[model samples]
Target: MSENWRLDPDRALPADAEIRKQARAIYDEIASLPLVSMHGHVDVDLFAANKPFRNPADLLIVPDHYLVRMLVSQGYTPAELGVPFTDNGGTVAGAEASDVETDSRVIWRRFCENWRLFRGTPTRYWLEHEFAEVFGLSAPPSAENADDLYDELTAALARPEFRPLALLDSMNVEILATTDSALAELDSHAELARTLGPDRIVPTFRPDSLLHVRHQSWAKEIAQLAEVSGIATDDYAGYIRALEQRRRAFVAAGARATDHGHVSADTTPLARTEAERIYTAALRGEATAAEADAFSAHMLFEMARMSTDDGLVMQLHPGVLRNHNARIHEKYGADKGFDIPTRVEFTRSLQPMLEEFGLSHDFRCIVFTTDETVYSRELAPLAGAYPSLRLGAPWWFLDSPEQMRRFRESAIETAGFYNTSGFVDDTRAFASIPARHDLARRIDAGYLGKLVAEGRLGPDEACETAIDLTYNLPRHAYARHERNA
Candidate 1:
């Protein structure tokens, strides 16, 4: 049995000779295009600080939920892998809560030894590409070479050119839009923009935290928003004014879009009086869960209206049942790889808002779903009809190569290419950016190549579409061109 693996150039392409050759040609044409990461969750401070990555586990293992979730699925305690649990501080010995591992080497060892758990996964493909292309590793990580690889990565990271900003420059990133909360100060964004110009590093406004009235942090976020935006928030109108003011601030800091992550796609509106009543109840810490849902849905409709006025692209990602394992969440905090995908309905859920602004010149909405079942039935038909809507690339659980191919086969017949938002990395793991984009480019090229081999599209046209998908589409979808216009 082989413990080591190497990435083949034709990986993620078709198996047939003619199709593979055509795919390679298409991929090669756009392989050198600078990545336009229109939307992501990367820490903007990583660039602003310009710090060198400290160690192998820190760079590859700690920040990646993909790797963490897999290892955790295999019955590994997150503590065993050095993942920090929720830091509430009192530890009962022999309990998982207080068992945070401090030694980085131990975590690296655990990850390398069980590396096979990542097989047949996008996490594996990304690691292969990172190991081979990014880090120049001759072989895959394993228990035997783990120590040696760690030493090598530590040494490489110490070099001046391996700093975060330098790595981004070397990766040929044309632009990177990071998600920032509505209450953020944006000091880091400003600093980074000065380092690489306004186009290279930008922010995306995310206000979901402040939108849900029943959330534990909702009132706190609203107060912070009022302080941040210099607006009074004693009522719903002022609260909205504070949010709108925050959006304006984000745009001034180079944000081109606003991100909303909800459990459902519903955007139904409530009357003004009902919205005000819900807001007051929420501020008083008495809003019911059902009332909170109605208020959140109304805020979504309001956000769409705000986008129509302000020209910020609206990105909606719904249908994630976050923190399914209450036990894990209680000990490890939220976003600890326990989030699961649920089916989402876009046609009905979005009809209320779409009927108002579906064809508006200033409005654009990009909708993402983990529900692959809707790609053909609801998402495709909706995007095909509404000038305001575009289908987001397959995300979260559906971002693997096979799933990506399935997405193309499912949506292309109805939504086609331009009706989609192109490929969105939507990742928080910073180093994985290039590998993710490369994987997407290859998958898209393979799909187009099959079309060419079947006489549905010409070779030249395939190349053009490849370029469009790689560079042009994202830039257009995210409104990067009109940053100051």
Candidate 2:
């Protein structure tokens, strides 16, 4: 363990003395404000059961793709990191099931031994915050203290104060939105509604599987959606109707938005007959790749139309090439952190959808991309012009401090502050939520302080802008769901 371990109160603030002083004052104003988690992947069932985490490894290392990917990149296999293997006879390359580590203590030690690998990364910052603020650990993780820390966490997690709902209250989270599939029953969400009350844990509709007709399991998922919605989906029109019904169910269950994870931002609508033909081919398991892409693009347009009618905000996260590592995917399943970003173009791709609903008062779309090149050249200009479009915060691979600064510098000139959605921690690791949000708030304070120091913005204006970026903007962007809840 590093004996010098300590988190500086002014970390990530401006380095200059005067600017750091200004930034610290701004940070203090919003540091304790209720967190509005507008987007995340935390499982609602954890709250439904209010169960203690199984172990330190299960809680920290297993589900976090960010950590798992880093460990794997450094020559550690997924099996060594305690990642569960698929039950359907999947095996890692050049490794056998017998080699997999099953003891939580062993995995924890391995992680501590390699703790230095996380230096200078956001993962290190988040882990430090979680270790000190969340878990109240006095020392940093090291090979010598791994077992002791693991035991401490295990005991702490067993207490009622550390239960899911109790921890949420302690964290001062006002709202948390979870991503759910279109075919999901949402029974856990319903349980959370009764346990935690309405809007505490809202669900967001995710239809990525349904949109990609070329996926091997598309037909199976369609059948599941039909069963859940009680609407036949054998034809194109029926599929649309089924999706609409699911959206209604989501709204009734306190959903405020629909999330799309597309490979590109293509939203060109196909002619009705062509859409039907593609749907028919997909149903027959014969749709070509080109046809599937066309169908997915058209479905994006249809989703926007549905959002306009239902009043659910639409969030588009495009440009990720998911499952880029076939070997890992075939061995461990999706979300192994093999997804990579590709160059994306939004101007021409979104023209059809934007032309249709860009001026609609009821329609709202928040676009996110890992490709930072589009922030200034395309996204900022598009958001500046469209009443319904807003740029999403830096996400996925770009959710680091340096990238966040670059994002603000590039996009804020054109889109201004209001045309951007506030920070949303798109995290699956529940404990990391506060840490991630804290990082964003500190970064925003530093950025705003610089503006005030440079005389570009008044101190009062900077403070108000900081508040909006931290609180008001997220509430406004997700207002419909908050109102419905």
Most lDDT-accurate candidate: 2
- lDDT value for model 1: 0.88
Instruction: Give the poorly placed runs of model 2, Cα more than 4 Å off.
Output: 1-6, 89-98, 481-485
The per-residue C-alpha lDDT of model 1 at residue 265 equals 89
The lDDT per prediction is: 0.88, 0.90
* Residue-by-residue lDDT tens digits, candidate 1, 335-421: 778898987888888999999999887789999989899999999999999999999999888999988999999998998899999
List where candidate 1 sits over 4 angstroms from the true fold.
1-6, 88-98, 481-484
Candidate 2 pairs with clashing backbones? none
Q: Which ten residues in a row have the lowest lDDT in candidate 1?
A: 89-98
Give one digit per residue, the lDDT tens place, for model 2 in 374-448: 999999999999999999999788999999999999999999999999999999999999999999999999888
